[model samples]
Target: MVEPTGYDLLLKGGRVICPATGVDGIRDVGVRGGRIAAVADAILPTSAAQTVDVSGKLVLPGLIDTHGHIYQYVTGRFGLDPDMVGVRSGVTTVVDQGGPSCMTLPGFRHFIAERSETNVLCFLSAYLVGGLEGHFYPNLYSPDGVDIDATVRSAVANRDLVRGIKGHAEIGGFARWGIKVMEMAAEIARRAEIPLYVHFGQLWGLPESGANGEDADTILERVIPLLKEGDVLAHPFTRHPGGFVNAEGELHHVLQAAIDRGLTVDVGHGSHFSYRLAKMALAAGVVPHTLGADMHGYNTQVPEIPAPAGTPEEHADDENHPFKGQARFSLTQAMSSMMTLGLPLDYVVKMVTTHPAKMLGMEDSLGSLAVGRVADVSVLDDVRGRFVLRDNEDYRVIAERLLQPAFCLRAGKRFDADSPILPQAIAA
Candidate 1:
C-alpha cells in the first residue's frame, strides 16, 4: 500500500498550552493546508515537509489582541501598520478598536485588512466618521457626530469584519454633553445587534472636563446604565480619572455589578496603564476578562517620550546609545506585565487566547488547538531572569519569567518576530 502524505508543517515536542482544551503538555502539532491536522504525543520528523524542533519553547494558540489601532495611512498619526502589530509580533489576530468608522469600512477592508498577513477584525466605531485622527477633534465625539442609521447600516453590511460597535464614554464627552453621546452609541450598538466596545477613563488633559461640569467620579453612575450584557469596558488599569479607580483611590463599587451583568472588563493596556491602580484591583479580587495592548503610532512609533529621569552615570559615553525613545511594546510585554502581577502563565495565556476569542465572538473557530481548526500558533521563548517592566505611571516591577515572541504561524504560514514594536530585553 502507498503511504499517505503527512502534514505540511510540524511543531515537535513543544510545551503546548491550549486554554480551550486545558492542554499543558509536551506534544507534536501537525499542520496541513492551513489547518491543524493533528496534535499528539509524537509525530516522526519524516512525516512532514518541515518539522521544527520547539522542545524548549512555549507553544500556544496565536494571540488575539482585543484592542489596537492599525488603519495605516488612513488614520495617519494614530495608525500603525497592521502587520507591524500582527503576524510579525506573534499576534495572529488583532481587533482594531475604533480605527475605522462606518464611512471608512470599505477602504479599511481593501487597504488594511485584506492586504495584511495578520488577521484584522474591527469594532466599528459608532460614529459615521469613524476613528479619524484618533478623536483629536473633541467635537467629533459629541452626540451629534454619531449617525445612528448610517452606523448601524454599515455594521450590518460589513458584519463579517465588524464584530462590535465602538464608542468613547470618556470624561470629555460626558462633560461636553453628558451621556447623550453614549446613549446614541448604545443605540447604534443595539440596532446593529452587536456589543459596544466602550473606551472609558478620562478623555481630556488634566483638570479639564465637560461643559456641563460633570466630574470624573460620576462616570460610572452615568454610563453603567447604558451598558448591556456583552458590552466591553476598556482601560480598567488606567492612571487617569474615570477609570476603575475612583478619585478617592478606591475600586469603584459598581465594577462588580457590571461584571454580574456580563459586561467584559478589558484591560486596554496603553500609555495610560497604572501598575499602582492595577495592583489595587487585583487586591480587591477584580481581574480583567481580556487584555488589549492599546498600541498605536502615538505610543509605539514615537510620538515622543522624554528620556527617563535618573541619577547621573559617570562613566557612560555617546556609544552607550542612550535610550531616547518611548517604551513601546506588543501583546507579549502586556502578558509579561500581567505575569509580573502574579497571574499564572496558563491564566495569562487564556487571557490572550480563549478569553479574547470568546469576547470577539469568534470562540467556536478560533482560540483552540482542535484538529481542523485554523493553524494559528504562537511560539514564545520563556526566559528566566530579572526583567524590569514599567507601566505608564513609571512604576516598575521585576519579573523573573518573561515571555518573548520567537515567531508565529498565521494560518499555518510562518511570520518571524522582526517587528520593531517588539520590546527589547531590559537588563536587570
Candidate 2:
C-alpha cells in the first residue's frame, strides 16, 4: 500500500516572490486541501505530511500565461497541448487568444477546456469562422467569417470562460480590411463590457500590388479611437509592416498614448516578436502588462523564419538555424527575457502573475498566494553559477545568476519537477 502522510505537502527553505506586496524572502509554504494554507519565515516539517527541501529555490504563484494558443497549433507544427506545455512549464493558468471563434466555442469548452489539467480561458475571436479552419487566409476573411452579432452573443453567454474578443491586423492578404475588422470586434467587446485584444502588425494596402502599405502609425490610428481602458494590444513589438518602431527608429506617439490610456500592452513573443522591438518598447517605458509565449503550431516548430537567400532552396533546416528555431520558450523564458531587459524581478513576477490576473479581471481569485487564494505555487531554483542570458536569436549575456523552477503546485497537488508541460529547464 502507498504511504499516506498526515498533511498534503510542505515546501521548505525557498525564496518566495509575492508580487502584490513586493515580498521576496526566505519562506516556507504549507499546502493543505489543495490550497496554500500558510507562508511564513519558517514552518516545522512535523506540521505537514510530506516535506520537500527547496533550500535554494524561489517560490512564486504559479505563472499565469495571459496569451497563448495551445489548442490552435499542433505540436511539432503550430499547436501544443496545454497540460503538457503549460503545467509542466510552471504555468497553472493559460488564456488562449483567438483560438475559438464564436461558433466553435462549445467544442473548446467540451473537448479542450473540460479535459485539460491547466486552467484554460479563452478570448473569443471576432471572426465567426474561428481557428478550426486554416490560417487566416484571404478566403477566410469573407463576410461569412465575421459575425459580429454571434460574437457578442457568445461572449455574453459564456462570460465565465470567455474573457475578451480578439482580432488580427496583419499585412499579407487580409490587410485591406484589417483595421475595420478590428474596429468592429472592439465595438462588440465594448458592448459586452469586456476588453478587446487586437493583434497589430502589418496591414495590406491597395489590392493590385500585394504589398504592405500602411505603417504602424496608420494601423494605430485606426484602432486607437476604438480602444477602451482595459483593451489589450497583443504583440506590440512585431517587426512586420506596421510595428512599434517608426521610420526614424523612435517610439511612435500612438504607442505611448495607448500605454497612457491604461490599455494593457502584452508581449506575445511568438516567432516574429523580435528582440529589437521588445528592447525598444521596454526602453520607451511600455512595460508589458502581460507576458505570453504566443505558442502555436507553425510558429512553435519553426519559430523564426530564415532570411530569403534569393530563393527558398538556400534554406536548410539546421537545429541552430534561428529561422527554423522551435517555439519552445516557456513562460519562465518570458520572465527571464524581461529580466535581461533590466526589469526588476518583482516587477517581472507581477507581469506574469498579478498584472495579468488583473487584466483578466480575476485578481481577486487568482494571481497571488495570500491566504484563502487558490493554492497555485511555482517553486524555482536561483541558479547562481550557470547563468547565460541570450538576446533576440544571436546575442548572449553572462549573468551572475538565474531563477529556475524546482516544482509547481496546482490546487495543492505536488507535480513532478521534470514534467514536459512546465518550463523547468531554465529553472533546472
Candidate 3:
C-alpha cells in the first residue's frame, strides 16, 4: 500500500470558522485532489506540497452568494462578468438570480456556466423572456408576458443549473395585473418542484394601471399565502414602497407568519437597502436568511467598461434609470450591513454559507469543510476601526467590526480577493 503522502495545499494556523461543522478556532486545513483532506488543530508542514500560514485570518467555507447577476454579453449594459463578482470578490459560488429565462438558458449555459472560473448557477426567471436589461422595461415582466408552460419546461430541462424560479411581487406589477403574475410564477415553481424567489419593492416602470392593490402594506397578505414552503422573499429591508416595512414604518404583521411557515427572507441588498427599516424588522424579530449582493451593471460601483461598439446607452443620461451603474458594493459590502446591525460573526457567516447552501440543495458539496467534501474556503480579515458606513436610505453609522475578504480557495485552487469593491487591503 502506498504510504500517506503530502496534500496538494495546506492552510495552516488560521482561525477557521465554519458553523456547519461546529468548528471555531485555529486549525490546519489540508486539501488534495480538489477535496478537503483534513481539518485539524495542526498538520506538520512536511505533510503538504504547499503551505500558507494564515494566522489571525478567518478561514471558513467558501462564500455562497444566493442572489447575483452575471449574464454579460447577452444583457448588454445590465450584466457583469461572473468572476468579477465571484472568485475575484472572494465568493466561490454565485447564484445568478433572474438573469436567464426559458429562451436564454442556452446562452447562459454556453457563455457563463461553462466559461466562468467561478461556479455559476441560476434561479430561472418567471418571464419566458428572462431579466432582459435587468427588467428595465417592466412591461416585459407583466403577467401577460409569462408563459407558464415554457417556463416550467425550461426549468425542468435545466434542473442541474436551475435551482429555483425568480419573480417580482411589487406594487408596480401588482397594480397592473393584481396577483395574477405572482400566481403564474408560483404555478411554474410548483410545476418545476423548485422554490420561487420573489423580489419585493417597486419594479413597475409603466404608468399605474389603476389601483389593483397599490398599498405596499397589503402586499404580503396577497403573496405570502400563495408561496409554498421554501419560497424566498427577497429585499425585506427595502426603503421603497411595497416591501416588508409598512407606510407607518413598522414591520408588516404578516412577515412573521410567513417566516414561521418556512418562508426564507433573503437580503438581496441593493440600492434600496434601508438601515432604518432593517432596525424595525429586527426589533420585530425578522432576520435575513441569505445575504445576497444584487450586484449588476446598474447597481455596481465599479468603472463602467461601457457598452460594446454599437450598443446604445438607452438611459445613459438618466441618473435614476435602474440600468445606470452607481454604488460600489459587493457581497461583503452587503453583509457589512448585517454585521453593523449587531449579528455575531459566526452566525453571520452561516447565513451566507449553510443556510443558502441547503436552500439551493447544495449543502452536501458547497457549505462545509467536512472530510471528502469539495475544498472551497474563504479567508476573511476581521478589521476593527471606527468606519463610517451608509445605507440606501442616506442613514449612516460608525461600525467597529468590519469583515473584509482576504482570499479564497475554490475546489482547492487559490484565488486572491482583488476586487475593487472597497479600499485596498493592507498587505498581510
* Reference-based lDDT, each prediction: 0.84, 0.71, 0.83
**Which structure is stronger by lDDT: 1 or 2?**
1
Off by over 4 Å in 3: 206-213, 302-314, 318-326, 421-428
- Model number with the top TM-score: 3
Q: Local error of candidate 3 at 372, Å?
A: 0.8
In the range 1-428, model 3's lDDT, one tens digit per residue, is 99466799999999988888899999999999998999999999999999998898889899999988899867665578998889988999999999899999999999999998898999999987787753446677777788999999999989899999999988777777778989999999999999999999876543545555467679888899999999999998887888898888877888888899999999998777888888888888898898888887667654255444422366444454444444456787677768889877877899889999988988878889998898889888888877767765558876776678888888999888887554332221
**What is candidate 2's lDDT per residue for 50-72, written digit by digit as tens?**
89998778788888888777663
Candidate order by lDDT, decreasing, is: 1, 3, 2
Candidate with best lDDT = 1
Instruction: Please estimate how well model 2 matches the true structure, expressed as its whole-model Cα lDDT.
Output: 0.71
Kindly state the number of residue pairs that clash in model 1: 4
- In order of TM-score, best first, we have 3, 1, 2
Instruction: Indicate whether candidate 2 or candidate 3 has the larger lDDT.
Output: 3
Error of 3 at 233 (Å): 0.7
**Model 1: how far is 84 from its true place, Å?**
0.7
Model 1 regions more than 4 Å off: 1-5, 206-211, 303-325
